[model samples]
Target chain A: MKVRVHVSLKNGVLDPQGRAIHHALEGLGFDGVNDVRAGRLIELDVADTIADEALDEMCRKLLANMVIENYRIEKVAA
Target chain B: MPFTAAVITFPGSNCDRDMAVAIEEISGGTVHRVWHGDAALPDGLDLIALPGGFSYGDYLRSGAMAARSPVMQAVVEQAGRGVPVLGVCNGFQVLTEAGLLPGALMRNAGIRFVCRDVKLKVENASSLFTSAYLPGQTITIPVAHHDGNYYADAETLDRLEGEGRVAFRYLEACNGSQRDIAGVLNEKGNVLGMMPHPERMIEPAHGGSDGRKLFESVLHGLNALA
Candidate 1:
């Protein structure tokens, strides 16, 4: 199975990298950019028998820091 | 009894030697340099220090990987037994990531690496690591890091203030830390994590002696217990 985890800073948490990117885009003369928030996408290849609970555990334990980030899991078609 | 301390060295920890020397000189004790792969700490240690640097090269967030290294498990266990732990800079990040302390160190709000001496006000001078300083006293220490902004929920921040667990606060903005907090103590007051490098300020040659009092305070506190 192929799994993808999307990790992003929570809404209230500040994102300095995202802000820098937003500023860079403005510097390049791009318009209509109100805000920017950056996140990470991690892909994994796991056994077909891997349970959903195990995937959730993976995210909770190591894939994302719950303190300031949230994660979503997506399954890709084989 | 002779004072004893251990300084943990993760692969990229550059300040371990400095920490060891500071502890040895201030406590007049045996200071052991422990490796990250070691499963256990030397027995019956008085203090455990986690020094500053890009541990594990700051991969997966600063101090995140190193917090899970084998040695940290023992560090946590020993800390649970009321052993004093002091973590500076990356060590502060590790302490938060390891759940030994609350909150997290985020990217500096200004989005730049900050390195220089800054003024810090002693917020709580009665902790095991702060007994030598007077309340509200100001001291100078050097802080070098990219992700030093401290973040926690409003409720938690309020609780930390109410409990007087905030150990040091920047007199002027240094890293965009919440409430300008520079250092914090655990609920039990046995653990401290800060962004500034107190070890770097322990001598006249190093710029000033403001940091020496911190080491001395810990030494005197431990001796008192003994």
Candidate 2:
């Protein structure tokens, strides 16, 4: 199974990289951008039998830092 | 027993030597260099020092990978027994990532790496690491890192503050750390994680000796216990 983990900073946490990207967009004459937030996408190739609980544990243990970030797991079409 | 300390060195740790040297010079202790792959710590260790560096290339997240290394397990277990742990710069990030400390270090608010001496006020002189400094005393220490901005929820922040676990606060705006916290102590006050590199400032040749007092303080506290 292919899994995608989307890791993003929590809403209330400040995102410096996101802010920098937003500024760059504005500098390039791009408009109508209200805000920008950065995130990481991690793809994993795992055995099809991997349980959701195992995936959740991976995120909680190593894939994401729960203190400042949140992660969502999605199954990708093989 | 002689003052003994172990400095855990992850693959990319650059400051482990500096930390060991600082402990040897100030604490006059036997410093052991422990590899991150080791499963156990030295016996009767007085201190466990995690040095600053881009461990595991700061991959995934700063200190995230290194935090889960084999050695950290032992460090965490020892810390639970009230062993004094000092984590500087990247070490601080590891402590938080390892769940040994609260909160997390984020990217600098300015979106640039900050590397320089910044003033810090000793928020809690009673900590095992800050006893050499007076409460509220402003001290200069060098901070060099990209992800030094500390973040925690309001409730955790309030609890840390209420319990006097905030050991050091940036006197001036250095990183966009919440509440200007530069260093924090674990609930047991046995672990301290700070962005500034006190080990780098232990000698006058390093430009200032303000960092020396921290090692002295820890050694003093441990000796007192002994």
Candidate 3:
């Protein structure tokens, strides 16, 4: 199985990188771009027997810092 | 009893030598250099230091990978048992990722790498690390990092303030840290994590020696407890 994790700063948390990109977009003459928040994508290759609980534990333990980030896991059948 | 300290060096840890030198010069103590791959810490360590540097090149996140390294497991265990731990800069990030400290370090609100001398106010002078400073005294220390802005929920922040767990606060707006928090201590007061490099300020030639008292306090505090 292959899993994908999308990790992003939690809502209401200040996203400096996102704000910088937003500024850059305006500098480039782009319009209507209200906001841009940056995030990361992590893909993992795991055995079929890997349980959902294990993946949750991975996110809670290491993949995502629960303090300011939230992680969403998606599994794709191989 | 002689002060025994260990400085854990992860890949890309540039400040390990500085941290070790600071501990040695200040306390005249034995400094042990431990590698991240080690499975266990040396027996009977009086202090464990996580120094500044872009550990693992700040991959994924600053100190994220290093916090999960093999030696960190032992570190977390030892810290739980009340062994004094001091984490500086990237080390502070690791402590948060390791769950030894609260909050997270995000990109600076200015979105630039801040590297210069900044004023800091000693908030808690009674902890093992800050006992040498007078409460509310302002000291000059240099901060160098991109992701040093601290963040925590309102409740936790309020509690940290109420309990005097906040060790240091930025006197000026250097980072967008919540409540200007630059340094904090663990619930047990044995672990300290701060963004500024106190080790860098031990010598007068470095501009100011305000940071020296932090190390001195910890050294004396530990010895006094012995």
Candidate 4:
């Protein structure tokens, strides 16, 4: 099994990196840019029998800092 | 038994030597060197210091990986027993990631790796780390980090203010930290995490010795307790 974890800063939290990228885009003459926020995607390979509860625990423990970020797990067939 | 302290060194830590030197100079006591992979801390430590640097390569997040290292488990345990721990710069990030402190340090608001002497106000001078400074006194300490912006929920921020947990505050815009907080103390006031490097400012050749008083104050507090 393959799992991808998407971790993003929660709303109301400042994303300075995202803002910098937004500025760079505007400087390059890019248009149609709204607010930009950045996040990370972590891919993992695991046994198919791995339960969602176990995956959630991983996110809570190491994959994401719950204080400022949120995470979602997507399971894909290998 | 005079002011024994330990400085935990992760693979990329660059300031452990400086921290050790400061402690040795002020405390005139044994300074134990501990590695991140080590599982045990030395017995009867008066202080534990997490020095500044890109620990664990700052991979996942600043200090995030190092926070989960084997030694931090023991560090956390000792901290629960009221052991005084000081985390400077990246060390501060580790403490927050390790759940020993509140809030997180994010990228600088201007998206720059700020490295310079920043003026800081002694917010809580009574802390073991800041007793040498008068309340509201301004001191200069150098801050060098990219992810130094401090963030916490409003309630937690209010509580830290109310409880005098804010040990130091930036005197001017340096890293865009919330409430200009540069250092914070734990609930029991035994653990302190600060983005600025006091060790860097200890020697007169570093241009100022304002930071020396902090280490001196720690030793002074310990002696007073003894």
Chain A TM-score of each candidate structure, as shown: 0.98, 0.98, 0.94, 0.97
- Cα deviation of B125, candidate 2, in Å: 0.8
Segments in model 4 whose C-alpha atoms lie over 4 Å from true places: none
Candidate 4 per-residue C-alpha lDDT over A1-78 given as tens digits, one digit per residue, 9 for 90 to 100? 999999999999999999999999999999999989999999999988889999999999999999999999998878
Cα lDDT, model 3, residue A44: 99
| Residue A40 lDDT (model 2) | 99
Q: Which docking band does candidate 2 fall into?
A: high
Candidate 3 lDDT over residue span B58-160, tens digit each: 9989999999999999999999899999999999999999999999999999999999999999999999999999989999999999999999999999999
As for DockQ, the candidate ahead, 1 or 3, is: 3
Of all true interface contacts, what fraction is found in model 2? 1.00
Q: In every candidate, how many clashes are there?
A: 0, 0, 0, 0
How many collisions between residues are there in candidate 2?
0
Question: Whose DockQ is greatest here?
Answer: 2
Per-residue lDDT tens digits of candidate 4, residues B7-105? Answer: 999989999999999999878899999999999999999999999999989999899999999999999999999889999999999999999999999
After superposition, candidate 1 runs with Cα above 4 Å error: none
Provide the global lDDT of candidate 4 against the true structure: 0.94
Error of 3 at B90 (Å): 0.7
What lDDT score belongs to each candidate, Candidate 1 first?
A: 0.94, 0.94, 0.95, 0.94
CAPRI verdict on model 3?
high
Candidate numbers, best lDDT first, in rank order: 3, 1, 4, 2
